[model samples]
Target chain A: MRLENVWLRYHRRGPWVLQGIDVRIGPGEVAIVLGRNGVGKSTLLQVAAGVLRPGRGRVTDRPARVGWVPERFPADQPFTVTRYLTGMARVAGLGRAAADEAVTSWTDRLGLAAFRSVRLPELSKGTAQKVGLAQALLRPPGLLVLDEPWEGLDAATRELVPELIAEVLAVDGSVLVSDHRGETVRLPAARRWLVADGSLSEETSSTDETIAVVEVAVPAARVAGTVARLRAEGHQVLRVRSDASTAVSQALPVEPPRSAGAARPAEPPLGMAGELTAEQPEAADDAVESAAGETR
Target chain B: MSALVRMRLAGFLRTGRALAPLLAGLITLGTLYGGGRAQPAEAYGVSAVVLFPVLAWQTKILLDVEPDVQRRLAQVTVGVARERSAGLLAAAVAALVTVAVALLFPWLVGGVSGPVDPGDRSIPVGLALGLWAHLLVVPAAVALGALASRASVGGAGYGVAVLALGGVGAVVFGLTGSVAPWLAPPIMAAARTTAGDAAALTLLGLSGWALAWSAAVVGGYLWRRRAQG
Candidate 1:
């Protein structure tokens, strides 16, 4: 998909939210969009998703089936979770049986099996976000655009988000996701696109700073603190294991602290093995199994 | 496009909001039926007074059931033209029901009284013309409602406009003894039905006027939407 020199404003006299922005993402590539608040990140995503038309220039080669999950899903509708997902699945071009099966599968995968019959308006924020995610994935979109997909999600579900992205990528689909919390480190590899001042630019990371996936094992009681400490020390803790065992392992980068002041000591902390493992970007399955084994 | 139309139609039908049109239609039918032994003019006046505004208001309520966000989302799936067509089709359904009830009420309640011209095979012809004429009100009122919505007019505002327009049309037709002045479908139908001479020409003229008015209103509405977009 490609947007070539797109310019957009809400109204004829309104100021432009996006100006001369050109970007493209090929099939199976994930593009992580970064920007501060009110910097047209959502607008860019909407234009790319075909929800909004640009005033000048054009978007070409967008897939017929594009899935878009807005920052806040409009969950005040009268339908139940299952009904809504089924309707959306049909709208996205699924057959009756396919739509039903997709709805059931996505609801279960997103941990919304219990809320399938529950009305949308009655759901909590996290549950509603899960429903939003499920709807976006129900039809296996050719291009997936998500705005703040991680916001309001529970820890375990947040961990599952990367797997969802990987699933889409495995099907040769393109994904464009916007995140403010930098949680996209969980993605295997992503091209960073930064939006500022109504313009977009691709940011290139230096080759010297490589991201490594580390497996951490800690007691269940210290899981939250361990993840927080890893994050505080400038290590991007991707996911924490969610099994019924005393030991918990997290996959995180082995990069040093971003800031000199936040740097940790040369030695790894107690009960936390910060071994410098090689870059195993496609080792998500092995990581899950290792985390589960440590818990046993 | 069919899916969107079905969705809108289903949404309109499955809600309590659908009752507004039904109630308005019932009231119009009742008023027309109560005008027993009266001339067709009385029936037409009653229809104008009660049916037009209420039907317009009911259509507004039905259309409002799909929130703006949902509408926008649907528009993304089906283009804007399809979305607007679906909404208009739904409105037309409500209008058709109301008009059918109004036109058929007289036959249902018992044939019209006090008017038996042996040469006047024009009653059925008049009835057909009237049906065609009155059906035009649906598209007109829906177009007016769409324009009102675009202008951000509240429901009460559009309702009042519809009622006032109908009332003024009736009053003007009464004073002029000509349906052409107001372009009011009900009044034109009534005038044609009561007119003993050249009823066919009058019916044709009335149909032409009603259709022209409907086309103009709906055309203007489409123009405004395109302009805004």
Candidate 2:
């Protein structure tokens, strides 16, 4: 999908929320829209989602199926969770049987199974956001646009979001998302489009600092906690392999310091393993298994 | 579109927004036909005239039931045109329900009295003309509702004002339509035609005027939405 020199204003004499914005995202691509508050990030996402038509230019080659999830799902309605999703599925062109199946599947997948019969207006913010996600994914859309999707989500669901984005991309769908919480770090490879002054500019991803990979060994029970800490600290965990040599053996490769001035003395548990040249997958299956095992 | 219509109707019913206009319509019908018997066509003509505002109000209520965000979601799910048409269709369905109740209310009150053209007894002329008048008014009323919809004009207060004014215009100008019939919906003409011995050409003309008014209002509404977008 492509927006060609699009311009938009809410009212006839209103200031332009978006001006001369030209952006394109292809199949299998994800674009993360970044901007400060009230900078039209939501407006840009809305335009890309086809919710708002640009006053000046046109959005061309928009996919037939576009899944749009707003920042806040308006759940103050009369329908229950299941009923609402089913209705949305049918609106998205699913047949009755298919709509039901999709609703059931999505509700369960989003951890909303227990709330299937619960009314929307009674749901908490987090649960409502999950519902919003489920409705959008009822049918795998060719273009998925989410505005502040991470807001009001629990930790587990927050992690599931990147997985959902990956699923859409796996189907060769394009995704446009706006983020404020920096949770988008999970999508390290997503293209970043910064919105400022009612215009969008793409940011290049290039860093030239020297790199180092530090390997750390922690107890099996602490493995999950340690990995979480490392990731939170801006260090990338490369791999997690169980060791039969001891109770458990884990290898964590940490990224170089964010800045040269922040270099510090090495810690005991963390030792500098040789710098790894290649980037590892963000969510390795073994890492997930280790985390789940720790939880269990 | 069907999904949207169904959702809107469900919302309309569940929200209880359908009650005020419905109760108002029933009460008005009861008061109009209470303990009084008249020619079916004439009574129904007056009934149709009063029901015009009621139907328009109901349509507006139905159209405005869905919140803006949900409506946007529907628009994204099924394009703008389909979503919009769904809202209008839902409103039309609500208007039809009111029409059905009005049609039956008089009979429930034992208000019909009269024969057809002195030779025909197969179909009651009052009933036929009542149905015809209602059919004639539905499009125009729905259009007025659409014009006064929250989508067309922002804010609840403003929408109500627009609808009330439009309803009054349709009634007043319809009654005095001889001065400038094209300025308002042909509702009064419909009632007059139903109550009197009207020619087939005249009936066709009323239908044309109603349809033309509906087209203009709906067209302007769709254009406004597109422009606002």
Candidate 3:
């Protein structure tokens, strides 16, 4: 599916959330919509989900199935986890008997069986997020839209997220997401789209990062595993620093975003306005040199 | 409709929240008309009985939201808007019915074999009808709270709203004319006035109003759901 010349906005004086954004996800391709907070990662995802109509452009090549897991799981009822997922499955058009079977399968795969009998409000944040994610995957979809799904999960559960995505893709579904810690993902072919200043552009290792720079290195063989482990632990493991063999100092393994109600980071970036990346932003030689030099 | 019925039933069992208070109000009203029965030596159960709706709505609205990605993604989910609206209305109506039944129970039971002559039960009828009218208004108020939740409106806001709604109902009943007198029927549904003139008129009017408002609120919810992306 491709979004072409699309723009969206809220009430008057409300900033333009997305402008002149264009990108495409080919058959069987996954694209991670990337940006700091407030960049309309959700709005864009909604538009794709057909929940919101775009103000300016068209999102084309849609399949009949669009799956979504918003940041918050919409399980406000006192229904047990199993009941709720089955209810959602029914809503998605699955028959009762089939929906029940699907719910059981998803809860097992998502490791929510322990919580199967618990009501939504009583579940922990991570458990709740699992429910939210399970809502979309109960049945295969043509496209899956996940908004910051890794936010409140634990390390073990976080590792399962990418695998879940792979499973979705395996069944011929494509995924679109907006996450920052990208290294741990096994979807080696993911395209990156950076959103800034309400504009969307495909980043190809060239997007600029004006923030402070820091570099640390580990063995190459351990790089992917190390990064995945760190991210699963919930650190904002930025661009991989693959240049040296700086021995491990006192290390804080990446932590999965804290439990569901975990305190949100103080200030997210500006809304998606500047540009989007359909691939990794190119770290120019000079810029990498400067980022490497900035630390010294 | 089954979903709506299920939600409404859940609303009934959520006794510790809004149902408790609504039940308390009914109990008091029933006592007034019951020739005085149905009260506990302690007031704790009464408090629990009467304040259920307010508690349920306040808790769900204030804390149920995903505080983390609230602004960006809390409401986005699967299914169409009508599904949510129907579910909400079903839930709210079911809850309201349970509360009405509890409040009106004393008079209902008393009518079967008590000192109050069956025909003179208008007072209990009025109070019950009055409270049901109030319950009918609650879902809209709670939904308003739910909608405004994204804006971070506090419990104080809901408190003010519920108190104001209740107060207004009381004041209207105090006035020469009933404030809305809109819910006279469901309140008066089991009244001894089952065969009266004024009693039937008020009941019809109140029923029409509650039904209309419920339909309208559910319509609004559906619209919002459809509008979301």
Judging by DockQ against the true structure, name the best candidate.
2
Which regions in candidate 2 have their CA more than 4 angstroms from the true location? A208-296, B116-123
* Per-residue lDDT of candidate 1, residues A158-249 (tens digit): 88888899889999999999997656766638899999999999988755334444454555666777666655554555444444222222
B19-81: candidate 3 lDDT, tens digit per residue? 444555565655544553422211112322233434334433333232323222313333344
lDDT of 2 by residue, B56-169 (tens): 888888887888889999999998889889999998888888899898887888887666467432336568888888888888889888878888888788888988898888
The regions of model 1 sitting more than 4 angstroms off are A208-296, B28-50, B103-127, B150-229
TM-score of chain B of 2: 0.94
RMSD after CA superposition, every candidate: 8.1, 8.8, 10.8
DockQ in order? 0.23, 0.60, 0.14
Best model per TM-score: 2
Could you tell me which 10 consecutive residues in candidate 1 chain A have the lowest summed lDDT?
A: A287-296
Tens-digit lDDT string for candidate 2 (A35-54) = 87999999998998889989
Residue A111 displacement in candidate 2 (angstroms): 0.5
Report model 2's TM-score to 2 decimal places: 0.83
Number of colliding residue pairs in model 1: 0
Q: Rate the local accuracy (lDDT) of all candidates.
A: 0.67, 0.80, 0.54
